[model samples]
Target: MRLWLLLLLLFACPAYASEPAVDTLPPELVRLRDEGRLTVRALWAWKLVPAATATAAMELRAMGLDLIGADRAQLAAWVREAEEGTAAFSPAQREVLSGLLAMMDSGDAAASADMLPADAPAAAALPVPGVVDAVPAAPDTVDTAPPAPDVADAAPPLPDVAEAAPSVPGAASGPAMYRCGAARTGVSDASGPAGPPVELWKLKVGDGPCTPPVVLDGLACFGSVDGHLYAVDVATGALKWKFFAEDWVDQPPAMAGGTVFFGNVVGDRSGDRHFFALDAATGSEKWRFKSLYYGVNSSPAMVDGAICFGAGKHVYSADPQTGDAKWSLETSDTVGTPAVSDGTAFFAHANRLTAVELGADAEKWTFRAGANITTCPAVSDGLVVFGSDDFNIHAVDVQTGVEKWKFGTGLIHHPAAVHDGVVYAVSADNLHALDAATGTEKWKVNMQRAGLKAPVIDGDALILAAGNFLVSLDRASGQERWRFEAGGEITSPALAGGVAYFWSEDGHLYAVR
Candidate 1:
């Protein structure tokens, strides 16, 4: 009885051991494929091998994903099954699987399905997401269907070829040049004598003050450290749209054609900079240029089918159509926007004003100043007027490259604006009007304790923003005409349409008529 019992036990133990240890799959994986919790069709294209295939690796690389250990033969066999119209996958899924397989064979691992020929059937398929192996179904549970034809067996269509280039419109004749950073192309049409100020309308923008606004096709555009460039309706002061940047925008925007351009500082060293062009009507991004130097502080200028701006120590001229750089002029230090006149470009670098011939790629001349130039040069009436930190206003003959004259103001800031024949500028405590022809001081007004910014001229009034005051003065004399006070610092220059537009440092943009 004991021997029989031992034999029975030994046999039972052997039977138990041979029974394939009750194979069990993980709940997560089972849920992934079986219940549509995840789909097996998506995993068909993943290459199983790391080496043995360059195309597979590149595909993974372009998607910013990593592939570790994988089996090449297993991956290929799986792809072949998918391409042959395996019923386990939908037609759309099989197409994606085939593309992934072809990418692997081509050694273009990063190649995207979008790069496939438009006529390729796989191009119409939706791709699977994520990375992992599909759980194989039981043999009895596998779907039965007719196998698909291999794509490699079919000849691809010939590539479409083109020879004649498309015609483009010829460039329009260049607009007349005005030197003084003044937007005025010629004398104004208004001929009325000075009288009582006319009120148009007043609309408040925000609390933080902003730079003078640029007007384009009835849209007034300006930027603030508040990180927005606003376009307001020129007639109604109604909000059009606001474009946001990564950081503060201290400079006014430049508007040309139908685009608006501006820049901002970014990154740890503030060395990361970006320039953006937005649609003038919709405020959508048209294009952008980024750099590793601190953001551009100078406003951009457009001329001769190019957009030019200063970035770090280089001056860039980019194609207006595609934002492609045409050429760059490298410099040793920071520079300002180049003023274009008659195919010549003038810009201030450190303490020197340099002239560059636009198409010739040569320096025409450079005039030395005692201090750095922080303001844009105004060109008009055959003379160039600008301010320098050296505490003097220098007037140079544009044609002869000679210093017409220099007047010391004792306080250095930016240069003056020239209109008619007078140069208007401001020092720390005084505003001076000088004769542009000879640089002779015409009249001086003591501000006592006021802090003034660059001035703008509208008709017969000089618009100036100082501290909390936006003051208008008679152009012929230095007498204050009208003043409006708001409770904030005035850091930007004033702009005038029919009404005066200015911003307060307290974050408010104001329009006074």
Candidate 2:
């Protein structure tokens, strides 16, 4: 009887937010596909471009194009070679070729930032190096010479950067942690700003990439590498309060019922980890739990009365009120944050993505990938989506564990976001929008070395963190609407109440309107 009920629950449908249909490509872009081959060679030049440009000449050569002198004669010579009819170029093809040649002659750098490489470069994109570059450095070595400093007692004065946005009326209460609620689908409940975004203010926090802030009740909360979880006034960019975790706090805190749940890594290798429940009103510790693990970087997901998070190779569900262990499930390797839907909790580790029946202590099913899975699973519309070091974005059945479909990408080190029926995925330098049902490519654009965060859906724009820029693109056509450059690599960003909040690796928190 229980099995039958479980099966019914797995296949049940849930309410989904309304989203528009994917946009068709521009006429010029449509012409690039001729008989299954992309004749726009420059569009695929990304395969040959180096990860970072060193010299203009090297960049051109790396993209499989010649670096010619900036002269009309030189450009004409190259044009003539292509115009002489090698592949029976169509008018559209010829125009694209001319554009490529012109860009090459003029040393256009944006060309290399877009597109995938074919031939030799495509093969280079497939290798899984022994050391995965997207994985951030673990807090391995601890300075044993002196003890760590204490938590901040008084609110630090906000540093001068940009003017803060005017205080807006926020929720009567606080914002729920993670993705607004326990679902963790990466969808923001707060409406995004309309049209091009503008920077409102920036405040320097402790060093290290700041975890995506959890906004609620006019306060934005996040932890920093300098061992502090900070609460900042969202409207004025003022520091509200800070709690020091004696160790590094890389994961965002989960808030529920006016309490915050978070964890920190231990410096020593003894593998002693700690989880704490703090009063949302006061930064005072409410309860603390110690686990025999090295760290807990996974953001906690609150379901039922328990808060679930992953530490090392285990997933622990603890009572949100008392921080007592409810149960623990061991995975093959270290686990990412778990996303809950229906009665299942989804997590990824090593090369396997597994689903556990919450509170039942039973396995639902597991799907294996070709390589390590680093990002958390985003669940919506009866499907789960995640990216892998295997250079593929996978979508799978939420119930039967069937392989629905997969899309090949360069290296998907971040999570994929799904809304309405579209999946937004990032690889190396490209952002792809795929049909959520069949994994068909709807449209794609280059993001110039994209960062490791799931794209946030705001009104009509899909916000992305790309290297040092916070970029907003048209959800339908992948067109750039606006960009805000930062001092360092930007991590994940959060959107709420017409404002987008994010942090950079340079230890600064920014609010853009």
Assess candidate 1 and give its lDDT.
0.55
Across 71-100, the per-residue lDDT of candidate 2 in tens digits comes to 334435546754774322224334444554
Best by lDDT: 2
The total of clashing pairs for model 2 equals 4
Question: Candidates' TM-scores?
Answer: 0.60, 0.66
RMSD of 1: 23.0
- For model 2, name the residue pairs that clash: 46-117, 47-116, 47-117, 175-216
List, residue by residue over 1-513, the lDDT tens digit for candidate 1.
999987888788887546553212233333453554332222222221122122222122111111212233434565675466332232333354455444334433235436343322231232333434443221110122112212322312211112212121122222211221322222223222133444344345531335566654556678754456776665655555666565546567777667778776431111236888877666778888885455565667777777777666667778766788877776656656567677676777777777776655667888888756655677788887777756688888887668999988865454466788998888776889999888888999887645576766767877676767777778899998877676575644434345555555544445556
Candidate 1 backbone overlaps, count: 24
lDDT of each: 0.55, 0.64
